[model samples]
Structures are given as structure tokens and as C-alpha cells.
Target: MSGSESSAPAGQAAPEALSFTVHSMPQPSLADRRSRVLGGRLRLLLVLLACAAPVIASYFTYYVIRPDGRTNYGTLIQPSRGWPADLALQAIDGAAVAPAALRGQWLLVTVGDAACDASCEKHLYMQRQLREMLGRERDRVDRVWLITDGGTPAQALREAVEATGPVWMLRVDRAVLARWLAPADGQALGDHLYIVDPMGEWMMRMPADPTPQQVKRDLDRLLRASSSWDRAGRE
Candidate 1:
């Protein structure tokens, strides 16, 4: 064997030495990791805010931007009550109506028995008139008659409702209806007209026997204020 080579077994090949190279990877700093996490959370928050912008802008217009400098005639419902998801409403034709489907337009709602007495008729008339008075803005409002009774509505009531073009005639349980809509002092739910915003929030209640002019003023203000965010029809 040469001096530089070590001898092994006479017939066996020599084994080669193994070599390894170590390379260290840099770990992210705590501040860098925290900044990345914070950036992701901030992005998620911004997306949520963007989704809620329309609702927030509408409310801001109603509460903050009073163009006419006149107070709302309808009593404002602070922290407005949202439409009940479990209402199980039914259309006049007995079709299932989803509460979510009622969103995306202003709602002028009236509650009463299927009989639709004189008071009910009067409120329905006012609802129709108020919507009509909006003229070009009329498409922005929807009239809803929530029949609390179970039986079929009276033929006269049905005919009257049909006369009001595109009115949403729906039936809801009286007990459930009461939980969402209320009347003024010494009055029934049938006495007042409820104002639901485009977002399905019951935000205002017109007084019992409200004057047409007064109700129009309130409706006008809402329509005008929400013009920036609210559109004419439901999505």
C-alpha cells in the first residue's frame, strides 16, 4: 500500500469518507410575525367593514345628515329591531315567504286581521297613497299587509289589496307579529304604520291616525337621506 492510502482487507474495496455541509435558516423575529398576523387581521376587518358600508351609510344619513333641518315625525326606534327570521310568513296564495327575501327596499307595514276592518282599510289606503305620493321615488318603498289571522282574507279585503299594485300580502302569526311590531299607548298593532328600512330593520312607527302630509314628510326624509345607499328595488 502507498504511504497516503490505508490498507483494508486484501480483496475488499476501501470505504469512502462521508461529508456533510450545515446551512442555518433564519427564524422570523417576533415583531415580524406579529406584524404579519396583525396585517391579516386588519385585512379581514376591512373586508367586514366594506360589506357593512351600505347599512352604516344609510344610518349615518338618517341620524347625522338632516338636510331639511326637520325632525322625523315617526317615532325613531333606536337600535332598530330586525325582522324575525323565524316568522314563517306566507303569501296570500299560500306560498312560503322568506323573511330574508323582504330585504333591500323600504317597507311600510300594516298588521291586522284578514277581515280588514274600516281602520285596516284606512291604513292600507294611506300606505298606498303615501307610496304613490313618492312619485319617482315610489319604487323605493314597498307596502306590506301582514294578516295576523289564519283564515282566508275576506273577498273585499283581497280585492282592495289587489287594487294596490304589487302590495305584499302576507300572513304571520299574531303572537309573533306582536313581538316585532308595537302600537302607541292605548292602541293595537293595527293602529300604527311601521316603517322598516331597506335592511329589514323596523326603525320607525307612524303615529296613530297620522296625517298624510306628516307621514309623507317622514318618508321623504328617509328616501332622500338613504338615496346615497338605498336603491329602488330588492336584489
Candidate 2:
């Protein structure tokens, strides 16, 4: 037998085999990738809006759905001013307190000397009564007495303040306070009761020597307006 012819048995065939090649998918272009990312972001934003719809709708019902001619008892400060961060302030215990720390709740602020005269007592009384009138919502409003002078508050005044409930007795510079809380024309800061919103904007100012009934109406409106968003306490 010849060397090449004798390699396989007669009439026998070589085994057959099959093979395949795999091709990877093409990569996405930059524009396509950006569009996919934007689509995901839009979906996330839509979910957030759905979660916040109740709060947004409640505010819309109070502010936009109301009649255009309605008037508020308190004067709305045009171009609302925010609390000053740099103002020097201290608590009754002589501990330093940042002015901005007073945010996150409604504030009824009265500014005067530490001596606290009769007029000052009257203002403090009105503040306490107004908050108590709120019932369950009283926690949402805080009473703030900003003493502008260096003298410590009198013992009697301190006792009276404590009897009124929680009062944030903070001492601030007189000149610095004048820049933020202003009185009506022909009046002083002590003459008016200032209202600060939960977000720290000084939004309203009650008239000098305002009647409790009128102030109550204004506060009721505010509480109703903010019911959906403002909770009863700070963090």
C-alpha cells in the first residue's frame, strides 16, 4: 500500500464538524446616551411632582382660588426681607445664639429695651393671648422678645415672660434690628408686632396697638393658608 492511500480504512469517511462566530452588538453614540439619561431624569422628576402634588394643590386652593379683592388685616411687606445672619444675638442664659437659628416656625417678634415698660408688657400679653388662641396650632408660632439694650431683664419681667409660656428672649443690637424690622410711618419698632413666616421671611406687620380680634383674624388666615406645608414645630 502507498503511504497516502493506506491512511484511512476503505469506504470510511472523515467525521464532520460545525462551528459558529459571535458578533458583539454596536456601542451607543454620545447623543443616544445623553437622551437616555435625560429620559431617566424626567421620569424621576415626574415621580417627585406626584409626591408633592397634595402640598402644591393645597397652597393653590388657598392663595390662587380665593377672590382677588380679599384684604388681609396685617400689612404684607413688599419685597419680603430675610433674617440677618450676622446680627449679634444671645439667649437669656448668656449663650450665643445665631439669628438665623430662629427660622423654621412662625415668629411674633417685639423689639424694645430690656427694661420692658408697660407698653412692652401689653405687647407681650397680646402675643401670648394670640398664640394661645390658636389652640393646637399654638406650637407653630413662637413669641420672640428682642431686647436691644445691654441691661439684663428684670426679675419680675422674667417671671412674667415665663408665665406666658415659651418665649425666645433674645438680645440683639438695636441698630441691626432696625434694618430688618421696621414700623409704620410715624411709629417705632416697639409699636408694631412683626410676623415672620416659617421660611424666615418677615412677611407681615400688625398695626401699632392692634386689637386682639383683628390680629386673630390675620393669624387664622395665615394658619389656614399654610396648613398643608407648615408643621407645628421646628427640627
Q: How accurate is candidate 1 locally (lDDT)?
A: 0.87
TM-score (C-alpha, index-matched) for candidate 2: 0.79
Q: For model 2, which pairs clash?
A: none
| Count of backbone clashes, every candidate in sequence | 0, 0
lDDT of each: 0.87, 0.85
Residue 71, model 2, lDDT: 73
Q: Flag regions of model 1 displaced more than 4 Å.
A: 1-24, 29-31
Query: Mind giving the per-residue lDDT tens digits that candidate 1 earns over 74-115?
Result: 999887898666678998888999998889999999988888
Q: Highest lDDT: which candidate?
A: 1
